[model samples]
Target: MSETIAFIGLGNMGTPIAKNLIASGYTVKLYNRSPEKVKGLVALGGHSASTIGEAVKSADIVITMLSDDHAVNAVSEEILPALKRGSIHLSMSTIKADTSKQLAEKHEARGAVYLASPVMGRPPAAEARQLFILLSGDAAAKEKVKPVLSAISQRTFDFGDAPYTSHTVKLMMNFMIFTIVELLSEVMLMAEKSGIDKNILLDTMLNTIYGAPVVKIYGPLIIKEEDNPNGFGTQLANKDLRLAQETASEVGAQLPLAEVVRTHFEAIIAAGGGKKDLPMLVSYLREQSEEVVK
Candidate 1:
């Protein structure tokens, strides 16, 4: 609560996380490319920064919740130069493990610590402070920041000293989710073809052994075709699948489900459904069938 926290990226997940910080009595500096996006947070006691340097230059801790590897790295360049020694940059982006490792080296060389703190949970869960954080990097830094991380997350799983391990685990976690989404899509279509409502099938699953949070959450989204662009987009979901496959190859691991999921995602993107909400993958699967059963 005492730390001056600079929060970069004000997208869906970032918004709620920053709000939580302000709610918890931290001095929060908010930065985003679209300065207008920070206004709502500003109204909530967050100070808006017109530039990345302005946000991070004096902060004791910086947190990045950017879109992808490129966006995270782009800001890292500006952040690295302006951030003071001993400051912590807690990156909560889902990115490649190698990218996290590279950032760790750069941060360490500058006498700063980089904590790979990829988080799980949708915007709603974040708003509720139910997000799970997969953390790795400096152990001392992890202890120093647990309160800050815990302020917005239900639990933080520390993966030890290697910063990139958390990102690797994040990719794995997303792969499992994508695989579940693929199964949900198929089961939904199968039920639809057999004169069963997708909603009913999902209802039964939720009451039985299949009711994990991903199942409970994505099930309804797929059934209702909730394609809100502000939620997790289809294209970014595909990018994570691709990252999972790439990370698999680096370890000489075989992921048969990844290939199948990637094929479906590519088809969805090809048909211009890339920006749709992830559960709308049902639309892609339905297009491949005899008829889109309602």
Candidate 2:
């Protein structure tokens, strides 16, 4: 018989990951705070769960992909009492390392297993089942979930029994991504001020030594003044940056560039771009250009 899995938090990324699991022939019990979000999955023969507790009650595995530490904490508390003994809880959200470690211990005390398996990639990657997962937990627990993880991700990087390791790596990765966006915004602003066409500069950069897939993917949006239909919204990006900054502060690490990126995001949010796509930071950069000209 196939394993029964409970997938909670059916947001943009979670929805696709769950769809991939269902396509891969798993019995998935899907639950989302907004029940409407799970209607498509329900129509596809997946089970709709009314609550988190109801979702994992009979499942062999539980997976969560929520927004922040508070959301994860709330779901964990609500579901821990209902989870069957020995069932594994795979947390796929990018959260604070300390929070992940604490939750892992709490779940272990409840006779349940927990694994920090935050993934790297956006919605498109999730839809394609091409996410790269970073996992940290007991080897045996990791082994048990390997097949399910493989179904949704192209590769999984194991970081041993330190649950916080995976979360830390995820935050560091986001720091790099956000910093790149900041640099891209600054460079585009400079080019525009120099009478260079933004598209021309982008095309040249894409074909040169500075080119990579990230720029190739995000460059056009930055240049075209398009802001809607986000792959990842600015609010979430700002949240992740704040989490990274908090983690860095806890470890006495100096993340000067990340600090600047955080400030840029704060400016974006203050300017009412919070609901827009993250790449919309270019709009803020353009505003800065106008201010400089005046």
Which residue pairs in model 2 clash with each other? none
Error of 2 at 291 (Å): 1.3
Clashes of 1: 0
Give one digit per residue, the lDDT tens place, for model 1 in 1-294: 679999999899999999999999999999999888899999999998989999999899999999899999999999999989999999999999889989999999988999999999999999999999999999899999989988999999989999889999999999999999999999998888789977777888889869898998899888888888778787899899888899999999989999998898888888888888889888788887855344
Residue pairs with colliding backbones in model 1 are none
RMSD of each: 1.7, 1.6
User: Model 2 — TM-score against the truth?
Assistant: 0.94
Q: Which lDDT values do the candidates have, in the order given?
A: 0.91, 0.87
Q: Give residue 198's lDDT in candidate 2 (0 to 100).
A: 87
